[model samples]
Target: MEEERGPIECRVRVPATTTNFGPGFDAFGAALRLYNWTTLRVGNGGSAESLPPMVQEAAEAFGKAVGEPIPSFECAISGEVPCARGLGSSATVRVGVLVGLNELRGRPLSRGRLVALASALEGHPDNVAAAVLGGFTISTDDGQTRVALGSQLEFVAFIPDMEMETEWARSVVAQTVSLQDAVWNLQRASRIAAAICLRRYEELSGLFEDRWHEPARVKRIAAWEEMRRTAYGAGAIGFYLSGAGSTLMALAVGRGGEVATALTRVAAKRGLKGICRRIQAENRGAKAWLRRPSRRLA
Candidate 1:
């Protein structure tokens, strides 16, 4: 945590993100208040044996992107964001590593370049872009990412006991969607951006319905239909699968606690052990800073 400039050290904190946002699949994303933290200490390239999988993957990607051998750095990774639940835990690691290394290397890569590298590493830009840029984001495959600043909103996150890997969840979705379904999502995605930016919470209920991914993937989560109904019955403005899914997000203006309580109760009654958390949107994105040691007294 020291701020004095001395031996090279960098710390990066990246937020967890929820992407797709119902009909906005692979396009819309918002950064949540939850975050993951990673720290890097520069030295000779260290052993890769013990590094976390995401960290390892990040390092490899960074080396390739920068056209340099990975430096020896001891890394300590920790965070509150849950993994394998579509919360961008992997993005946190990938982004943190790239950002941390960029700092240690005197930041040769521009932010845009870094983002492209991260997106390429992640196989898409949705979650990584939001985690890197913060706030609400819409990113395309062409390396263009946009952020829309707006009033913050609350979310009641129902984290189930089970884990659904993103790859598996994605595999269940159909590769080709109907033109009508595509049109259905296009209209709603545009409006969703306005609704979120304008704080029109009421407009979200209808806009949050999706025909592309949810119907196919919701079956993977235990009692998802029942939970959706329960959330609506409990006064949620709208709800959607958080990413690919074992975690559900219920949007609310002032009823976060009530919504969370209701979801937790329903989960318990259904013999599914899980907890609910009420979190807010984070406007700022990932942050990286050097933590140099304090100079000794002369």
Candidate 2:
């Protein structure tokens, strides 16, 4: 009889995501170069209670989706994505663990199925879709669509020192909106999606305006108008909130560094105290691979 393999390891790399994209609330998202990695090793007898809440939830969902009992495995996560800053840090972790678990079990779930699972856990599909598929994604309850962006585009992320919980942010939004406001958002969102899909970057200007979420969330961010003016003054084509709040993103072309510096200075001057990073959209999404096998010692 062949000797049984012992304790195989799998590693998954999932990119961070920025969703909402102004008027496209819960609809648009794009994967960024920032990443979170999760490594899973089987036969370690890891307990679900010990894992972070998000990881545990992901593990449970994975088991139920695949119709199998989750195996005993240790999980380790490391990455640059900051938590609760409107960047899809939670999605990255959830995707990482789910993909890592799937890889170790020989990938029983397809990428589409994985996206569906992650979206269900996240309570929204935008961030999870982009994090899983890469590129620009438009997500809805029915399905997700992706568009590849060019190298010329750059995203200047203004990450604040403070953190805003997604749940709290959602609580602040009005339960209902005016018909005019709803129509305004719909018009802009449709145009923005078309602009991105067609690569008409110039047309993206002024399309980021929204009457849905930003109007309410902007009040919570200190010096929002001044920072937005600074970003535009520095050659940003479009500016808006990344996800919920606390991290504002500027869409720029060749002037990313100028925009980043301007946003940083303005934020500090206004007492917000934050940093700006110039990042590119990641075309490739989450990836998984097995580590070299190691034998258990007797």
Candidate 3:
């Protein structure tokens, strides 16, 4: 039998993700350098209060799945991952909670089980898979996921002054798509995988266009056309809506600063207010570690 230990403390950090990447739709996602942090510890005489709703729910689900009497936990969260900007902020929170709890329970759950649990909680796996597995991920409807690493490209995200709820953005997407558009996106999605593998960054510009969700969703963003044009003019080779987006992201190598400045300047001129930041893809996903309490048996 395993010996008892001191109070367990777990800290988890999960990266933000931008899903779809123009044409992959609900299948593709990339982890970003931006992150959300959550710390969890076993506690006494208190409810799981003050935690994010997703975190609280995840804790309950995990406890039930493990069939263990779960101890009350205190959770604290802090990060720059903005909510409702299509950045997978909720995924970070959910993934962090699951990971932290798993560690506190001595990590009986496998990574695959964790992925499945997180995906189930998310109702979709793209963002959760990327947050859990890191790098770039493609999730299939058959409950399978493929991941690839190595993206040297930098990203410039132009955040808008307002927020767009994911439900509303999802509701706006078309229910039907033509076969031609489906084939078009499928070919490019395949090519994108190859391009990222071969480090063929120049081939991405053409691949970034989509005939499906982007067309329907673009109408919601004011000055979308102009923003796309300006992003390219500012030396971004490829640009796309970040997830469901109140944020637009441009892909570049050495031109992130230039692209970010141009995006902000153009948005300001168009009376849209928000900040722009240059960030890179994070290959490492969420990490959780146990910090044991100092030994003092007084």
Candidate 4:
């Protein structure tokens, strides 16, 4: 055991994701470059007696789900994804935990299996699908099938000052929406998917029009209209609420800075608090790289 005093460490790159694009509701998901890096160190091979209690609990929660014993080690996590926003913070964390442990275990979990488990933990497929697959993925409620997300589009997600929790926000949706609104969303969702496939950038702005959820969400969030105008006027192919509220994605065919700057000013003027940054979607998902352990930590 003294020969294994040190731990095995690894790094995972988990990208930020955009879900519920326009009217896709629970189906569509896109992966982005904005990511969280999770690094973990596992204790050397020892009996089940080697692990600590908190580490044991986390490992049990994450390990049994993967059909394995709880990892025998301690973990440290740090990164950019924020919690409680529409930006999928929970997905990032869960994926990070799974990836960190899997790496230490000689990659016992395959990529596809990891995605399904991540989706199960997240309670939704959108965010985890995008994070794991690194592109667009369509997942069902059970999260068994993770189809490759087939979109290579460039866009920016607008994050607003205020954060909206999905639970609280979702509770407000009426049990029955009008038929006209539902029809509008169905048509738009179809068109948006088609536009993405054909690479019809110009058609994007019109296709992003969602009559189902955004209209209602926008009414409550003060930052909606101004951010929309700023993105629209800046020649964004389209813009929409990223997930539920706060983050709004603007399409910039080639005008990345233009959209970021314009949205920044608009959000500031409204007396809202938030940050605006440019991000591009990665057709690929979670990735790991092996490097020499840092001397400082060593």
Candidate 5:
């Protein structure tokens, strides 16, 4: 008789991503050191019906992509990325489950293929591209381009005690823009991508100006103007909405501490309770590994 196969457990660590840096709306994203760890245990008699909707979707997609039926599995998620905060938290979960399932299936898909699947699930490529490839990613329909960010660069994120749903945020944005505004945003977005790729940090200044999305969304945020002014005054190179925002991010070279402090203080004065964190770019992206099954006493 053939021996029975034991249960397999796969764990994945997916980095948090900040997308839509300035005018690169839905096109730009970078991975941060903050992460969410997800574990998938297969052959444990776990039912797919018990899984969250997002996880189930990911698993179903993975099965379809690989041309195999995915076994029922149990999933556990733990991490620091907060949901509905424009921090790519949902992307982390989707990517984590996909990667975890792939690992358990003998890695039938390539990383690029996984990225494509993830982008589809995310409804955009920016966050999923960054989460999969790490560093800084510029995602266009043509493909994705990545650039390594130096450790000196700091991302100071001010996460308010509020949640802004991505769906609602997208609903507020206008579908039309003036010719001048379109040109302006295109120029800045292109320059910002080049600056990061060429390591021209100085050129990044003034290039984060956006004529789309932020204008409509900022109105919902309390003391938005003051937050931007304070961040700049405290040594931020560029400050902008992280994604669809309740959390704002500021780029600083070495002045992250000052910027974080200023933003925190200003938020408090505005009666907005929140936390500030200084994080660096995570170049390693998401990683998955199979856990060795434990043996029981005979």
Candidate 6:
């Protein structure tokens, strides 16, 4: 094949999300206040000079998976999520890359298809489902969408410093959960899904307390107790594991200055370095802006 370089760029928006919302494991998910912005370009491209490592890592992974390397591209990846902090960092990058690539390829893949593809690679649906579909999503195995809760809520995430590999966190759980614990998750997940679909944001608080996973993982994360205590003291409505552990997330009253300050103090005192984000519960999913070819209409 001859060398070719007809450059094109695509813009994409993807949001942060919390999975396992206390009780729902690999089942319940919620979109949060941060987002990943990126543009994929083919051929000669400009520079960001400060692309996040997650972004670079994600691009390389995408290239390997797709059987084609990421062509010369100008990509700017910036977001509030700290690396390895359980705030859907990987999902956002994956969605952003897939969105850009699809637009470049003349929009060949459907969003649903792309969602399944990303979820398969991510090894779970909690994060990717929220990033793609937005709002709340419930997926078991892969094909089943038992519940799809379109966005409807207000949330402010108190992200704490600390990191844990998802695999390491996963290793903490019991191979078999107690029968009662299983039933408890089932009930809360059902209620949470119903509340999301009905737009009953107020009821979400009850649904966020889990009986299956967070307790187990919190044991491994050093800052778990202090983070939770401080968040509740900060007037958070509810809280749960964003994904696995270490990256403590809380659903606070609002994404306002006071709430942020309270969480910041807590993080500082605890020595966990990270930022606070006023994440909007968005269900708009992945949207792309196409860069039209520069033309002369003289």
- Give the higher-lDDT candidate: 1 or 3: 3
Question: What TM-score should be assigned to candidate 6?
Answer: 0.78
Top of the candidates by TM-score:
5
Per-model TM-score, in order, reads 0.90, 0.95, 0.91, 0.84, 0.96, 0.78
lDDT tens digits, residue span 66-129, model 2:
8887876677888899989999998998899888888777789998899999999999999999
| Winner by lDDT between candidate 5 and candidate 2 | 5
The C-alpha local distance difference test score for the whole of candidate 3 amounts to 0.82
Q: Candidate 1 vs candidate 2: which has greater lDDT?
A: 2
Off by over 4 Å in 3: 1-6, 142-151, 293-298
* Candidate 1 clashing pairs, residues 3+ apart or interchain: 44-72, 45-72, 46-72
Deviation in Å, model 3, residue 142 alpha carbon: 4.4
In angstroms, the error of model 5 at 26 is: 0.4
Candidate 6 structure quality by residue, lDDT tens digits, 102-218: 677666666776677677668887788778777667776654353444333446566556677888878777778889888888888788677667766567765677776677777
Error of 3 at 32 (Å): 1.0
Give the clashing pairs for model 4.
Answer: 133-285, 134-284, 134-285, 136-149, 158-248, 161-273
Q: Model 3, 180-238: lDDT tens per residue?
A: 98899899888887777667887887688988888877787888889999999988988
Residue pairs with backbone atoms closer than 3 Å in model 6 (clashes): 22-210, 23-210, 33-279
| TM-score of model 3 (CA atoms) | 0.91
Question: Top lDDT: which candidate number?
Answer: 5
Per residue, candidate 5 scores C-alpha lDDT tens digits across 80-125 of 9999998999999999999998888788998888889999998899
TM-score comparison, 1 vs 6, better candidate: 1
Alpha carbon lDDT of each predicted model: 0.81, 0.88, 0.82, 0.70, 0.90, 0.68
Least well predicted 10-residue stretch by lDDT in candidate 2: 1-10
Show the colliding residue pairs in model 5. Answer: none
Off by over 4 Å in 2: 1-3, 293-298
Candidate with more favorable, higher TM-score: 2 or 5: 5
Q: In model 3, how large is the Cα lDDT of residue 179?
A: 96
